[model samples]
Target chain A: MSDPAGVIAIGWPQLLLATGFMVVTGGITLALQLGVTKALWLGTLRTYLQLLALGLVLGWVFRLRQPLLVLAIIGVMTAVAAQTVVRRAPDAPRGSYVRAWAAMGLPALVITFAVTGLIVRVEPWYLPRYVIPIAGMVIGNSMNGVALALERTFADMDARENEILALTALGASPWEAARESVRTALRAGMIPSINTLSTVGIVFIPGMMAGQVLAGADPLVAAPYQIVVMLMVATADVLGSTLVVLLTFRRRFTPDGVFLEKGWRPHAR
Target chain B: MDVSGPSGSGKTTLLRTLARLMPGATGSLAVDGQRADTLAPQRWRALVALLPQKPAILPGDLRTNLVLPWRLKVERDVAEPGSEALLSALDEVGLGGLPLDRDATRLSVGQQARVALLRVVLTGPRVLLLDEPDAALDPESSSALAQALVRIAATGTAIVRVRHRESDGLAARRLVLTQGGRLTEAGP
Candidate 1:
């Protein structure tokens, strides 16, 4: 049982390839969004430096083998990222978006460690690779889902504030006034993942299954894991999005259900 | 009912409070015999849309803005109003046959207000709370705005004017924001 993974050889090549992929992804996103070459270079490089620093920190921590520590790191990352993204959305209330992210991230992380731990106990409960990746997969998707959910819900409230007023006119309570936007926003947030499910293994080869196969695992062995991973991601995203929308709806509006423009930012799309 | 009084009487605050932004507000003012403080104001607003001091226009066509409220789940029956309807509403408000696809913000102040007022008409808010409206208008534009308010009021939508200056030509009940941050009724 010889391991090809070596501090002994082939180090810079792997590192270079990973760096290349990272640059390409960030470059494409920035180019499409902002369309400035210098901006893309600087933005992507910033992202590269940030991820590298984080990876260096996580690498040492993971080697320490405390599952609880791994869970905490992921939890904090999700919470902070969620706060950052939602806080920047246009028209968001001052502190509500950041608070909502923490609220969503806390529950999602608890579920991450608890439910993932319960299911992952196939004799050795602390498979760092699986636990970490699966947690990342679930929580990362949840982070995006929550962000979109908050952004859209707030936007919907702003754009359709009259309907909210109408609902209020029809004797709907403040919570009831936001019901439509919340539903539409939640549904909107789930669409990408739902579409991904429909196109799974067909439109593209998913990375998880491909990675397992490359590591010499059977396709059958990888298939169930991939399927479970996809499902969990969808579940976590939906749960996190739904909770964020609901709690956020309560905090986002005036008691009369007027959309508080200060609570969340706007999505350009 | 015409109310004309001094400046800084907090007329805007009255509208905002009426909208339920002050959930923990302990004081009370009744609107048509119901406590405005406790009544669910969103519902109140559907029947009555307040045109804020400066209702911002998003970067979109006039038709889109007019009909946006109808698409909300709460407004299942009100279809997105067509461009012709929006244009017609605008026309009724003295902005005859303006471009519906024009960028709203790029419109002149008077033009934008007409479009917004048309939006209220098409969207069907029964009460119009206008804040310092027509401050930027030329005399002709202000006169037209005055006429539009009269016509809208005739349709039974109560119009409340919070004005900083008199003779914007709105012949309606006016609430003056006093220097002491209170509303005292006055007549022209």
Candidate 2:
């Protein structure tokens, strides 16, 4: 399976070998009559097609090496990530999609640029190979952070309605009333990244590191890249969650500082 | 002043409205010749505090709960009461035995109700909105609470209390909320 570059080339036959794992999973689902076999197979097919399309597109972008094209792809990725966040946090207040876009896009793009341009010092700042993948990781992690923070914020708003009202009655502003909920939501959002940072190598080799190793990179050389990725992820998570929380907490109250009742919808814009 | 009505009547809603804690509520409110709309919501609420029927005990010790209002940025200018004043006020409200360091959540509902009342009262609002402040208290504790309200009223703070029990002789005037959601004077 080794190519001339000494890296294992995953051709159709090797992919068929990987498909066997899914077949085993499908068989287990069938044996248990788990109803999800149909969904599982559909998901598997979708994953294969989507990744194949992504690879072709990325290959084209890499060959061209145009900065604008790379940025366009990142913009599309951010839009999709924003939509995913909104879907994941269905109970979040209306207009949360816009906030999620800003929260996720701002930190992910900024940190990715900093990592590539300043830290990794990619020869050309807009190098597609470095920028696209780093931006994807940052945006993906940031999307999760924004979604978790938004969902936890709404849940806390419902659960802590009385506490918030109590604070307001004592002359606390909207921000003051929502302070505790924001803190908890930010913690919920950042905990996954923190856990990954703490247990990256000990518990599991992350996908990026594993991919580098499988590509014939030395394990010791690949370790530093994974460290940067993990730290960048944690930074993106905190910054995105903080922005989301700050923006969304005010929605829990009216302009007059009254806490909105559960299921209260915003005025049609 | 005291407001009384049947359980389904909107006494709580009325107090919340007075405190501007209702978004849909529309009316003009004035405090000491200053229009409410002119003041910031935080400042308006500071001048007119509401003590809800269900007390909200925060996650902290008794002292923290009592001084919660003072800790707010809006209340930065307001001086927090000293421990002696807090202890004496607690004694006045029939919660003297409770220590300052006691876990607030561990207190009984009646005790928490008193703490809620004390929290608003200590802020020294010009107008106090109390919703069934003594509903959970024993008769003795109820009397102490009534006496404390009277003393607070003496300091020129207008008191609007929603009560279900017979009058404790504190209200200068009493009003009843009819089922039609109208407030009418109740015969003394």
Candidate 3:
């Protein structure tokens, strides 16, 4: 299915229906003197451009199911996801973007391979239909997890500086001193996934399952795929956040367990 | 030895530097003639402990907080004291018969201070660095704390304490920190 019939293609008329709502919202904001009209219009334009570019790229990439091409696509997505995480989490330590990249990229790659190769068992093991969507879900969730973990861990360390230093002063190693903060960060990072697990079926159909159903796939099949996606996403998120926090906490302290006093940064404060 | 100075005199900074808690501090500190920086932090801390003005108590029972540091991987190689030893240390700090399961965080500041003091004493460090050890204590508690320090000192644990009050340093060799971080012996 080189050209799988496009999924519920929305023509310009249908898009105009959505655009009309945004325009009305912007108009109301302007009339009320809220001054958000510019933001509304700009956001709409940016979203439209980004999604259009993504659709075009995906269309080209999906036609060629070559392993190298598939890997390259996933790599680019992971890089963008990592950069997004670093940008969103501005309070993280300096030079944390590289660590963020590894944290999100490694876990996403591993989870994508396990799902695509072991469970889903795609014929080429790099099917754009399966691998691309799964990679997007896993990497996207992992990036969010990494960002949350970094932000929370840094804040926790700052708030609990006394506790950390107390432990260190009593012979705790750097890792030992940061054990509590790491635990807190991991819990904070993973809560979204845990909440999703409980709310997946009853609350609302998730995006992947909804898209599959809209594309004319069987609900039963889409439901199972959704379950698989959820598990992979949670695993990637947990692993990514865990690694990022564990790696980053060490940088906050000296080898001798003394916390390196972080100078005041505008966002870090 | 006692360190006395006005506010912002760096007395607390000196104590922390000697304890190796402040990485930015530059100077050579020694314990038993051994260079402090040469020793591993775990080893150095085991030998020289600092009791900060406000001791941070973990979220656990008194017993757990007392033994928490020893439970770390770095301290795993050292032999931990038995419950009896811990109780003895508690008794030495006027906390005899205090329930082992009592929450450390819930203790009064005075009681928590003693517990923090007892925690370091239990480690049997060769030197104790104290920052206003009785700053929060009442008269009775302060006297008790003094006796505890005397007993620990009698055991050959050298103590260097920072004190804001003149009366607090009467028994020790007092060094006043002047305006420019200069150390001078207190006048008689």
Judging by lDDT against the true structure, name the best candidate: 2
Ranking by lDDT: 2, 3, 1
**What's the ranking of the predictions by TM-score, best on top?**
2, 3, 1
- Per-residue lDDT tens digits for candidate 1, residues B1-188, read 33345655556656656545434455765556766645445445555556665655545877665665564434322456676666676777777767777677688878877666666555555556666567777878878888877777887767777665656545644555467666665555
The weakest ten consecutive residues by lDDT in model 2 chain B span B70-79
Q: State the weakest 10-residue window (summed lDDT) of model 2 chain A.
A: A260-269
RMSD for each of the candidates:
8.8, 1.9, 2.8
Give lDDT tens digits, candidate 3, residues A82-192. Answer: 788777766577677778778877888889989999999988888888888889999976677778888898888888888877777787888888888889988999998
**Candidate 3: clashing pairs of residues:** none
Q: Rate residue B2 of model 2 by lDDT.
A: 90
Per-residue CA lDDT of model 2 for A164-202, tens digit only, reads 888989889888888888889889998988888898889
Question: Model 2, stretches more than 4 Å misplaced?
Answer: A267-269, B75-78, B184-188
Which docking class does model 1 fall in?
incorrect
> Native contacts retained by model 2, as a fraction?
0.78
Clashing pairs in 2: none
Task: Report the lDDT tens digits of candidate 2 across residue range B1-188.
Answer: 89999877889989999899987888899989999999898988999999888789998999999999988988444589989999998998889878899999999888888899999999899999998888899888788888888889898999999999987777888999988678766755
Best TM-score goes to which candidate?
2
lDDT of 1 by residue, A1-269 (tens): 33563113336677688778757777787768756657766876798699778778768776777767776777676767676657645555556656666656766666565655676553345556556676677776666667787789878888776555434433356676677788889898899889988999999878889888777678898888888878877887788888777766766655445444532333332
Off by over 4 Å in 1: A1-10, A13-59, A122-127, A255-258, A261-269, B2-27, B30-188
lDDT at A177 for candidate 3?
Answer: 84
